[model samples]
Target chain A: GAGVSQSPRYKVAKRGQDVALRCDPISGHVSLFWYQQALGQGPEFLTYFQNEAQLDKSGLPSDRFFAERPEGSVSTLKIQRTQQEDSAVYLCASSLGDGSSTDTQYFGPGTRLTVL
Target chain B: DQQVKQNSPSLSVQEGRISILNCDYTNSMFDYFLWYKKYPAEGPTFLISISSIKDKNEDGRFTVFLNKSAKHLSLHIVPSQPGDSAVYFCAASRNQFYFGTGTSLTVIP
Candidate 1:
């Protein structure tokens, strides 16, 4: 089966610009999550979605970061007015269940965002 | 503050020998722990996991041991293979998951 995947493997944006990263979870996956990973650092949680509802947005750094999964299949993480500090690899993961089960999360290759 | 921690930044082990990776967490509420392996330009893949109620779990050549009282866990790979050389991350979750900085393991042939 195809695993989770992300588009635009690499993206370079100027400071104050906006960028949108996409994620395609495995078919039938009911849970999706986004994370940010700085060089040599572990990934940090961003937000989570179950089906079409955005459940947890507490991990989002600020208001500039937004995410949506309207149809319950694909998701997009949008960053408005990106900052140099936001430069990092954005990762997406999906699981079989909505955090209710101990199902392991399958991660995507990730999108490397470079903010100049 | 980091809830889960892989104190060792890197580890080196001779091929065919046993390699051990250790992790610790400060939050006692974490009931589930997982280990993931990652290669360059790739995402972290799930390796093995153990629930707090269980002290150990094994899969093929990999084994994960958890010590709930110490808030510590370790992954043991017997007969280490060169292909196992990569970054290994330890993660824990109560309601939300948290990952450690990760340890880069180099398996020498």
Candidate 2:
């Protein structure tokens, strides 16, 4: 089966520009999550979605960050007015069951974004 | 604050030897723990997981041991192969997931 996948493996944008990163979860996955990983650091939580409903957005760092999963399959993480601090690898993960502690997350290859 | 922490940044082990990676967490409420492995330029892949109820879980060459009292977990790999060389991340979840700084493992064949 195909695992979670993210598009635009690499992206370079100027500061104050807008960027969108896409993620395609597994066929039957009901839960999706986004994370940001800085250099030499572990991934930090960004946001979460269950089906088409956004469950948690508390992890989003700033108001410029936004995410949506309208059809319950594909998700997009959009950043308005990109900053150099946002230069990190954005990762997407999905699970077959609801976003619970027991469900193991399958991660995508991640999209590396660089803001200059 | 980092809820989950991997104190060691890197470790090297000889092939066919045992590789042990350790992790600690501040949250005792974490009910489930997982390990992930990653190569450069790739996202992490789930390796093994253990529930809070069980003290240990084993999968082939990989084994995860959890100590609830100590708020610690360890991953042990036996007969480590060169292919096992990668960064290992420890994650704990209550409702959301908290990941540890990864430990880079180098298996010399």
TM-score of each: 0.98, 0.98
Question: What DockQ do you compute for every candidate structure?
Answer: 0.72, 0.87
Model 2, chain B only, scores a TM-score of: 0.99
Native-interface RMSD of candidate 2 = 0.8
Expressed as tens digits, the lDDT of each residue in B1-109 for candidate 2 is 9999999999999999999999999998899999999999788999999999999999999999999999999999998999999999999998899999999999998
Question: CAPRI band of model 2?
Answer: high
Which parts of model 2 are misplaced by more than 4 Å? none
Report the C-alpha lDDT of model 1 over B21-56, residue by residue, as the tens digit.
999999998889999999999999999999999999
Range of the 10 consecutive residues with the lowest summed lDDT in candidate 1 chain B: B90-99
Q: After superposition, how far is residue A54 of candidate 2 from its true place, in Å?
A: 0.2
Q: By summed lDDT, which 10 consecutive residues of candidate 2 chain A come out lowest?
A: A97-106
* lDDT by residue (tens digit), candidate 2, A30-102: 9999999998899999999999999999999999999999999999999999999999999999999998988
